[model samples]
Every structure is written in structure tokens, then in C-alpha cells.
Target: MHPGRLEGRYVAVVGPADDARDVDLARAEAVGRALAEEGAVLLTGGHHGVMRAAARGATAAGGVSIGLLPGSDRAAGSPEHTHLLPTGLGELRNGLLVRAADAVGAVGCSWGTLSEIALARRTGVPLVLLDPWDLPADAGVVAADAPAAVRAVVGLLAGR
Candidate 1:
């Protein structure tokens, strides 16, 4: 990636942190890596589980990973994140996360992920779901895996 391809693009990876399954974590990690490879910046809740895994993957790819924390303390976020923005907005920070994203890759299902998904849909932001909840097709395009999900999101962003 020339970086300019997605210089200002932000892709949010939303999923369960504490309750994330191993499979979800793996998918999230792969998603993060793929996004980074395409020059898209990765965004997450910035705590644990999928968030931490995605941040780690982004870092591994030499990409930027921005963690948006709900706490006032920046140190409360995951260490893997290259940058941390402590919102102190608590759960309300979900809105900020979704709003900041040019697209969203949801690796798995969770209450928080659901909120993010809904926000994306309501705002008409492109959304890609991987091994997530049984959402309606109109809600978003459900991809078979991480790479496919990233592809779908990229296509959507390109207005394809």
C-alpha cells in the first residue's frame, strides 16, 4: 500500500473483549492485519480480547492502531495500541467509535458490537460482518472470513 490509498481511512473492529471466543479473536486479528496491509488505520475499543488482538495484529503489520478508550485514563487501554484516545464517555464512546470509522469490521457478536453495527447501519457507513450475529442481510454484508470481510469493506468504501 502506498499509504495514500487509505491515508485517512479508519476501519473499526468491534467485537467482544472479555467474552470474545478464541475464534473471534483469531478472526479479528486477521481482519486487523488485512486492513493494515491495505493501508487502513485500525480502531478498537482498546481493552482486551478482540480489541487487543486487532491492535497487536496492526502493530505487527507496521500499521497504526488507534484505541478509543472509554476511561479518562489513557493507561487503561491496551498496550498494543500505537495511540490511545481516552474518551471518558463510558459506553457512549461507542457512538464516537462508529462515527469515526469509514467502515466497520465486526468479527463476532456482543452487546457492544451490536451497538456499533446499529450505529454504522443507521449512519449508512459501510459494514462487514464476519462470524457475527444473525443480522438481516440489509443490516450489512456478512463475509465468510477475515480477508473476505476486509475485501467487502474495501469495495463498499470504494462505492462498488
Candidate 2:
């Protein structure tokens, strides 16, 4: 709740890595790039699909991309992530991600993504949407694409 915590705060990116032909990976990439250029860290599930795409985009911009893994094992780490946070809580690692972020970018959503989005809202952080529907209004939802998500988060960081 402190001012400027979001200035360079981490953004939690929640999505499914099971789908190889997902429809929203592009949006995730755009969101990641935007966050990176703004100098914010990107946090993810540490695998493929949306997570890998976002990590790649962020790392390409020279920003840090971190993966929070379940069960304390990182053998499946996405190559783009520079750090891995192994919580050993399996799916419950979602809580750690929600705790670490100043905001949330809910993209390529699935059952797991929905859980993360809901938890983030419960935590009272801002949220940007790429999957668009089924999110809480209390989350300060950003309705635009990835670029807009980044802009919204940056504005929040600036206290605008």
C-alpha cells in the first residue's frame, strides 16, 4: 500500500501452459513487452504457452522475468525466466505470485488463470485483462490489450 512500491513492482502473469495453440499468447507477449519497457518485473508460472511468451517478451526488453514454481522444483523452467521462486506448494504457489505483484495481468485464461485473477482482486491490487471476461470489478480492471495494460499499471505507479 505504500506509494512507489508499484514504481518497479512485479506484475503477476497468470495463465495456462498446457495449450500450445492458445488464442491469446500474442496479447501476453504485448503485455510483457510493455511491462519490461516500463522497468517492471514480470512474474509467471515458469513454463510454456502464455508464461513463456510473456517471459520472452520481457527478457528481450532487458527486464527481469521470474518464475514461481510449484513443489520447489525448477527442472521445467522456461528459458526466458532469469530467476525461479520454488515454493513447494504446487498449485498453491498461486498465492505467492499474488502476494509478490503490485498488479495482475490475467491472460490466456484457464481454470488456473481464473483462480489467480480472483485471488489478486481479493488482495486489492490492480488488474489488467487480456482474457477480458469473468474478473472482479474491485481489481481496477484495464480493458485494453497488452500495451494498455502496461500503461494502466504505469499510471498506477505514477499515482495518476
Candidate 3:
């Protein structure tokens, strides 16, 4: 989408961009789709695996999706991203992912995803988990189902 049309409203979606083979990627993608269906923007690492799937879900739902690339070169972007942000900071790129988003959503449990969850929690951003094994004691635990998680998060976003 045109960059001008997408601004102010953004939701940073953080998850494992490297676990496409080991885990069920469809679940993560479904979570992303749920986010998009709710009309919030989607954000991610902007590459393969979870990021790509999430981007696809958002786009399929007609929601804006942005990718915060970890490298300076633009070749790292996934096909589903609506906007590309190239940051040559490698793993440090997680910081940008966490900060740029108004709220954060986590799907899989991997190292990168864990870091993102930590960052989001530390930043005091609203967060939702699709299959969270562990989370803050006071986190509003939504149902494990994708639709329920989406509804819960959207309600949180809407202050419901």
C-alpha cells in the first residue's frame, strides 16, 4: 500500500521467522490473519517463516503490514510486506520491532519470539499470545483459540 495511506495506526507482530519447518506455520499465519481481520495493522521481521506468513495473513485480510528488515540491503524483504524498513542492525533489529509497534502479538515460542515478548512486556505495550506457555502473572489470558485471542487483543486495544 502507499506509505502515505498507512500511518499512526500500526501493530507490531513478533514471532519466530526461522521455525517454518519445525512447527506448524499455519497456526502462526492464522494468528496474523486474526490480527488483520480486526482492522489493526501488522508488523514483523519481514522475512520468511512467521514474519512472511503473518504478512501474508495481514495482506490477505486487506490490512497494512510492515517489515523491519535486519539488514541494510533491501534483498531481505518478504513478498507479503506492504512497506519495507531496512535496518542494518542484525539481531538488534528486535528493538525497533518492539518500539515501533503500539501493541505486540506473539505466535510461536522461539528465541527471537521470546526476546520480542520480553521487549514488549518491558516496554509496557499490550500483548497477545497465540500459544503462550508462560506470560506475566497479570496478563489477560485469552483463550488459546485463534479467534478468541484475536478478540481479546482487539478488545484490549479498544479498551473494552
Candidate 4:
């Protein structure tokens, strides 16, 4: 469970942090569970909404969950996070998450999620969109359903 080891595949689950829809949360949870089943470590924003749900799903599946918190207070992170990183960088920490991940799966749409997607594409990290933005095919973003997002990520990482 060493966050700095960089030995295992890391997947960042990016989405909104407040008042997320139940359907979106469910999809995020499924993505997290699927990533865990594939033995990929889960990373999230460590706040509420989709991030919390994804972390819970990963932990419930006996997988590691790491939180890159925007705030300085470690206690502000979701309870499901196994490792808390107090970045204190606000939304700018999104770049760190995108860079740390071998791949990224976005569960729902939001300004923050869009930023993450853009960062992933700009940084050459495989980006999987689950019920998120509809980017052009040439944008290098893979659009996938909740159940297929994990497979898409694995395939993308393998090809890279």
C-alpha cells in the first residue's frame, strides 16, 4: 500500500464532488469495483460525491484507495480513503492525479472532471469517459459504458 512505490497500475476516478446524482454515483462505484477486480489501485479527489463512492467501492472490494486531497486537512477526506495526501493545491491537484495514473476513468460530467480529462489527454495518459463529455474520436478519449470502462482502460494501458 505504498503510494509512492509506483509498482502497480493506478486509475484515477474523476468526477464532481458535491450533490452527485445517484445514477452517476452508482456508475462510479461500478467503475471502482471493476478497477479493483482488475487489481488496479484507485485514486480520487478524496471529497464527497463520486469520489467518495468510488473509494468506498474500491475498499469494499479489498483494494487500495488513495486520496489526493485539495485541502490541507487530512480529516476532510472521505472515510473510504486508505491513504490521504494533503496536497493543499485546491483543484490544481487534479493535475497530480492525472499524471500519477496509468489511466483515468471519468464517471460523470463536471468542470473538474473535464479538466482531468483534458489533462489526461494532454499528458498522454489514456482517458476513458463514462457518461461524461462527448469528445471527438480524434481527441484520443475513449467513450465507454460503466461496465466496459475498466476493460477499455486495461486495453489502452496495454497498448501504451
Per-model TM-score on C-alpha atoms: 0.95, 0.87, 0.84, 0.90
Candidate 2's displacement at residue 7, Å, is 4.9
Best by lDDT: 1
lDDT of 2 by residue, 23-122 (tens): 5777787777777877788999887888888898889877889999886678777888888777788889888888888888888577788878878777
Question: What would the per-residue lDDT of candidate 1 be over residues 31-126, giving only the tens digit for each residue?
Answer: 888888888899999999999999988889889999999999998999999999999999999999999999988889899999999999999888
lDDT of 4 by residue, 1-160 (tens): 4432222789999998775789889988888887787788999999889999999898998888999999999999999988999999998999999999998888878989889988998888888887776776755555557777877887788755
Candidate 3's TM-score reads 0.84
Best by TM-score: 1
Tell how far residue 60 is off in model 3, in angstroms. Answer: 1.2
Cα-based lDDT for every prediction? 0.90, 0.77, 0.74, 0.84
lDDT of 3 at 43: 83
Clashes of each: 0, 0, 0, 0
Instruction: Superpose all Cα atoms of candidate 2 onto the true structure and report the RMSD in Å to 1 decimal.
Output: 3.8
RMSD of 1: 1.4
Candidate 1 TM-score over all chains jointly: 0.95
Ranking by TM-score: 1, 4, 2, 3
* Cα lDDT tens digits for candidate 3, 1-160: 3432223457776667666543436765776776776667888888888788888888987777889999987777998888888999998999888898877777767788888888888878888776765767655344576666666666666652
In the order shown, the candidates' Cα RMSDs to the true structure are 1.4, 3.8, 4.1, 3.7
